[model samples]
Target chain A: MTAKTTKFVQGNEACVEGALYAGLDFFAGYPITPSTEIMELLARRLPANGGKFIQMEDEIASMCAVIGASLTGRKVLTATSGPGFSLKQEALGFAVMAEIPCVIVNVQRGGPSTGNPTHVAQGDVNQARWGTHGDHAIVALTASNHQDVFAMTVEAFNIAETYRTPVILLLDEVVGHMRERLTVPEAGAIPLVERLRTSVRKGVDYHPYLPRDDGRLPMSDFGGVHRYNVTGLFHDMWGFPSDNPGVVHGLIRHLMDKIENNAHRLAHYKTYHLQDAETVLISYGSAARSALHVTENLRARGERIGLMELQTLWPFPAEQVARECGHAKQVVVVEMNTGHMCQMVRAALGPPARVFLANRMDGVLITPTDIKAHLRLIAGRGV
Target chain B: MSVQDYIRERFFPHIWCPGCGHGTVLNNLVRAVETLGLDKNEIVMVSGIGCSSRIAGYLDFHTLHTLHGRALAFATGVKLSRPELNVIVPMGDGDALAIGGNHFIHAARRNINITAIVMNNRIYGMTGGQFSPLSGEATTATTAPFGTIDPDFDTVALATAAGASYVARTTTYHVQEIRKRIAEAIVHPGFAVVEVMSQCPTYFGRKNKQGDAVEMLRRYKEGTVPLDKQPADPEKIPRGVFVQRERPEYCKRYEHLVQAAMTDGAALT
Candidate 1:
């Protein structure tokens, strides 16, 4: 009911609209393939909306700049593709270590290193979860269509603000470039998470890294009345670098536990004909689009096929995934990358033998027919 | 306000080796802010990793100790977002000219209002005295046991070529000059670079047999001449403000751009 005005736009454009809707105050990014439109649109859009945008020299600077803006109590974002994302990993880890809130969009393209610039790939799935070196936790989200692209982009910012961590929005080249209809929601329709600034008095001590009773760390604006230090070193509650054994152990644990503990609550997905399906298809990003197409076509012929489209990829919802696929006779994990999500899907389920993968890696969108062939094989028929 | 009022006293018993010139540079910076009477809450001190980078932590302001060679990039974001706030970045020799060289030039190119203080110790002391980009040829370092072959970068020259509105150089021995240059840089409204030639006596001195901290300070006084000294000799390092001129700062230009862009957005709607 809140869908206000409908327009046809690319997924990247929808992401830009969603960021403004989420009250983005600052953005700094370097342009790369597939993800360039997001930065290009924001470059033109931010200034008019009374926000700030900068095209930094490179991806590393872009990531560092957003973290800097976020400390000044601004909601910030940066977008990049595969190679750019790789360049951003160190600074992204710095954001996590310093507990700064911001969003990073990797409109994923092929490559371990510049393999394909204009082609789609979901190969960075594992990279998002463990790209930054250290035993730290991360939040990664994705969407399969233009509408979900808009919603998930907003959700990514919300998660960043609430958790005080960097949130990655993963969209493949196909989803990023594909134009589709999206209904822009009414302003204030979807709730937003505002930054929680400290209530400590101006002259009083403000701990920049201390979490209160409910695991929420209230932050003081970087240039605000309270003067405090922010650093990448293992730090005390006062935000000063500390190498004490207790301090280092406690800080890393808190960073990991904060998001990992709330993974189930953060899990988001959509089910199509899942209630009574015998064959379940698990997919995310743009691959879910093909999976849904395959499910609907098979369902029209009286087959019990279902599609589970995931929105939250990291802090992956293992328990819920196991439960959803518990009753299904066979589970097929579909993706563009060969076995990234398939491995996770197998881990989430009890009988890994029933879990299979339907995938493509030639810079092509997985088709409905491509999925049906997997189903025919699963039904003990020749491919 | 007293000069002590500018420092975070709790962080005292600071993390510098004995006779390290970085402490002197820190002292000069503190007095400079005190002279300006800038509100402690309005100053954001950012620094990249190195011995001199620790100055950000000792300052009682909004401090950010960021990744190596990236302080200027981070400071650019901070100052551009809140142009009214005074942002200062203190970086070490290699931190500034080597890893962070690109950011330094670009920040100067944008002419964003930021005071970049390069504490030039001429060696990478924190990681145990490796030869830095600014270490110059014939300098002895841990990485350059046979003496370095890499040439030094003239900070003033690099900053001037990068379009900085203000460029100056001072040494730790000239403590008063360091303070004066910092105060002048702060009041200037565009990108300003102040390179202070602080000594790393423990490494750059002992490795090259340049004697103790006091001897190094004496050499600073004897080696460099004032910029206006009559004969402009090629042998001596000249010390003074190199460039000071006016230009529209990056943030103010963006503000005017926003005013025009609002009209552009309205037309689109």
Candidate 2:
């Protein structure tokens, strides 16, 4: 009972703890089921902690508000689900264009358009990458348990501040609603990344979009002496809107390269018993839990199978995935979506025939049995 | 500092057309801020996408040129997060009343301390001539070749009904009043709306056969009656502060809530 570090909480609640731990100074969100608990808890906790929390009139407003708050040099975020995520796509794009650091948590329920509210699906894997119009790069993280959820939530903020770009925390229903024990990490144990502020004095001109030698752009608070522009248009170093072809081209490439060039560093995942394996199962989010369970069960029976649980979905870790699963004779991706992550795995491995999918879309969580069935079929051993 | 000191002189020549009233608004806004003696570092001008929205680009304060019809929403976040900052939002007619209408009413209802300037030029100038929410029943535009059927929103009435503590209306013709009203709106402690009947000579005027900027201003002088000189005719647009009363500001109220939470809620380690 030494300070009781472990506490039982839902995935949504764990996320709140992680955000507060990450020094979230402002949060603006709209209520959407499967994600409402995040805002609800923050509404009470944020004010008490001297952080600002607002329930905006709608999803778009919530996203816009967070972006504005972020410009003022405050760490900001917003939480939503499928339909709400769609509403936020425009503002999300604005965040990308402006290079404002903020976090957006999409506790994805079923979708194409409001497919299910109480069920789980990894359907937003592609949406998180391509939902916002135009070509832009995004960092999306996911986890299968409360501890990982807590950790990834903190990482989302760190990554956002580091890149001066918005990070998406995509959680599915199963992990979001499931209650589990999470031991909160002691402060300073996981080093926090504060946004690098401009060192130039008040009289000197501060370039808001100018990158340093290490590729990180420093920022100035809205109330600071360096009063400059922040716009959604392709801008010069001064942050003013520009239509010049050179400026426009440089910006698009820069935005894409900032995250893509660093994909190796941005990738996050866990490998289990994959030193030497004949069959590999690639998965992430809530579905990875079942995949890990099946991997352990089949290993006990002396079958050479392993699990690779991916945390980074966007700037999809293509190189690491290809390198990790390259030795496997058969790779099966287990998830609750229609082969979304499976397609990425196949693309990484370069042959669809060797890769298989174990998926459930009937609002049921994929279990060990379901994954085992896919492995049996993929191994050419008919049950 | 002079009005020029508050502006980014590099980007001008400016973007507005020769007779576009948004320039007048930008000119007067600089004067208003200068008159109030507000520090430029303390000011944050946020604007939505439109002809008027470009006002943030010309002035030198911390500016956020945001998405269409979402200026107030962005300003709400900026003001509420940093209560010490002065947040001003200048939106176009369609930008505030059409796609951004919900945000407009809610921001007013919250009585947040942000000055909202609605430059009502009945047609959409940025996207060429299109009938706006402010284009009354008979106005013709590129979109409404046969004349519009949409009724215009009464900016004063809407702001007043939506709980804005300071609601005022003026025309681009009244250059002095623009400075007076905007300065007053900035000084007001609660939500304030100044609906400037700004003329869009390039689009709204040409489409409506209202001559040029000069003719439009001539019409504004004849059309609007002052509050002190109350006219019986309902057709005359009234120009002056219509609603200026005290209500707790949103950011101030939030501060009180934060204080209460800190004093009474379970303490965090």
What DockQ does each candidate score versus the true complex, computed on alpha carbons? 0.78, 0.73
TM-score of each predicted structure versus truth:
0.98, 0.98
Tens digits of per-residue lDDT, candidate 1, A285-357, equal 9899999998898899999989998899899989888888899999999999978888998888866449999
> Which ranges of candidate 1 are over 4 A from the true structure?
A1-3, B230-232
lDDT of each: 0.91, 0.91
lDDT of 1 at B92: 97
Model 2: residues >4 Å from true position, as ranges?
A1-4, B267-269
Writing each residue's lDDT as its tens digit, candidate 2 over B1-269 gives 88889889887777888888988898899999888899999999999998898899889999999999999999999999898999999999999999999999999999999999999998889999999888999899998999998888888899999999999999999999999999999999999999999999999899889999999999999999897776675678889999999999998889999898888667533
**Per-residue lDDT of candidate 2, residues A316-354 (tens digit):** 999998888888888888988898888888888895438
lDDT of 1 at B39: 91
TM-score of 2: 0.98
The Cα error of candidate 1 at residue B167, in Å, is: 0.3
Clashing residue pairs in candidate 2 (N, C-alpha, C atoms within 3 angstroms): none
* Candidate 1 lDDT over residue span B1-269, tens digit each: 78788888887889999999998888888888889888998999999999989999998989999999999889988987898999999999899989999899999999999999999989999999899989899999999899998999999999999999999998999999999999999999999999999888889999989899999999899889889882666678899999999988999999998998898986632
